[model samples]
Target: MVAFDRPHGMTPPQAQWELPFFNQHHHTLALGLADWAGAQRVDESDDRRACREWVHKLGEAGWLRYCVPAAHGGALDKLDSRALVILRETLAFHSPLADFAFAMQGLGSGSITLGGSDAQREQRLRAVANGAQIAAFALSEPEAGSDVAGMKTSARQADGGWVLDGSKTWISNGGLADFYVVFAKTTPDAGARGISAFVVPADAPGLDTSEHIDVMAPHPLATLKFTNCRVGADALVGTVDGGFKLAMQTLDIFRASVAAAALGMARRAFAEAVAHARQRKMFGQHLADFQLTQARLGEMSALIDAAAMLTYRAAWMRDESPTQGAGTPAYTAAAAAAKLTATENAQRVIDMAVQMFGGRGVRVGEVVEHLYRDIRSLRIYEGASEVQLLILGKAALKT
Candidate 1:
């Protein structure tokens, strides 16, 4: 059977998976966060309340400080992609909610970091990094999730401001965020080019999130209704009629981070499977004694490593690329490739781990069971696996 003997000194699992693309600084962060995450377990009994508490805890512990730039009181000079990768992978290894809280702080306010005016960044980015406020990305709607241009929501210019009229659903941190980066149509017939982004405070009049959305994996989500919701001219984020581009650009960086999150879940499942294989017995012999079990374990290990390599490579390339350049063709393709391979592979790895656990795996609260639920949504969100394929295909054909 495959075996791993850890070194005498402390070794975070993140360190063991390190690539040459990352430096000692990355490994150090992984070790620190791995220890921190193992200690802070949030209660999921109340998903909404628990998410709030988790965000506060993560901020208080300083992990959320990497979400923005040093100009706005962040730890890093800018949003470091590799650092984001390590943080998400380590946190997800311990708790998916924790990773979610951390990721939203980055993604929800990502457009602001990339294109916000100086005052806008000063107003929101620092608070986000400090976790003084929760952030939400409000892009998907009832009918416009994958087909963004199909959105019916409109932001009409009114009284030196814009009045938002429509709804957004399936939004993470929906009912709980301090602010949302909302995307809407500014010009009715201009297609993607007419869309614009706005920073709408949760307290904006007419904004409603009374409907709590339930999913297979428990988390805080809701449908937001913005009937005549209005905000000042200063609330516009990035360029007017540039919302679609901004949304895509924001997702580009976080896409690889999503892959990192999946990798963590995959790693945890592998560890559980390995431990079980050594202890489980059948036919008067250990489960590891069976050739079938060995083969299953082998495949699981290979897939996990392959996913890690892809995820790390993608993250490294994105970080190496210039900032404010997330929409560049090369970076977009790399991000798409990593997200596709890692999330899909993670699902397979987690499923195999559940199979190895036999009947115990399907039990409601088993780690594998929870991971199984947690990983399914990854393949569907942040650009689905099919979407990633089209992106890569377009790039390949062009080359």
Candidate 2:
């Protein structure tokens, strides 16, 4: 494990896989994030602590600023897919939780970045960008993982404010978030259009978190339940009927970045596997000396490169899309494509790395072993591979 206590002073390392498409600024950012990530150690104990620490450090370094807008302390006017992809990919190579910490900052605060009022954006979004506060997005429910219309949470008009009731499940950064961007059914008969987004403060009346979720890769997660949680009308985010579009738009921007995170993991695995093949002796020769082993390593390298291309292509498409008349950027398609390919490829790449390590691969605490667990959740989160496939298929028919 990289020692977390080491002061954060190192620059990002030189990237071995820089592509011709990256500008000087991007290459510089990539190298800096990578070098900074390299010096840090993953904590084997208490992942939440590790995640929180990662958030503070990333925020302190001004990386979290990318999650918001320039007016709200971000580096860019809007979320930049290329920047996001590069950062996530680099951080995932070092620690999945670090990537998760960074991602949630964007995902949780995205609604505010995209649609919040100037006051809300200035106060809440700035806190998140500055690392002074943690934020959570509440959209998924027990029955609404991919179906936004199936949510049961509801909000209604009250005397002086809005009354919110019901629960949100699978909320990332749940218990730890200082505020939540919650989605609730404001008009059940309107189906998906009836949904609305609200900015719920952590200390709001009747807001509660039942338990911290212990997942395969531990981070700050929980189930949030609201019992008549009250917030003023100013808390309403965007248009009441426009919540679904807002949610999808937020996901569209972050989706490709998810793939970038997977790409980072694959790159790390490939690097480690190659190093092992060269060093580990087998029978009469080094593993890399064997033709079969060489073939496997070659295949892993090819897959990593291919996945990286697709990931970057998606990011580039989103960024370079024509702003004049571009309606709903093909980010949905690009993100889905990137997420599907990178995640599925990451699984294969990690499997190959683990195989190359032989017995040591499965041993507890091995780099490959930890990676094995870390890589599994990437395929399942944000949107599952199956979900991405559906999105891509729908997009293909449309195009």
Residues 83-179, candidate 1, lDDT per residue (tens digit)?
A: 9999988777767877888999999989999989999999998888778999999999999989999898999989999999999999999989999
RMSD of 2: 2.8
Q: Report lDDT (CA) for all predictions.
A: 0.86, 0.82
Clashing pairs in 2: 2-41, 12-31, 12-32, 12-35, 13-35
Q: Give the TM-score of each candidate.
A: 0.95, 0.94
Candidate 2: regions farther than 4 A off: 1-20, 41-44, 323-329
lDDT of 2 by residue, 45-117 (tens): 7876777887888899899998988888998887788899888887877677888899999999998888889
Per-residue lDDT for 63 in model 2? 91
| Each model's Cα RMSD | 3.8, 2.8
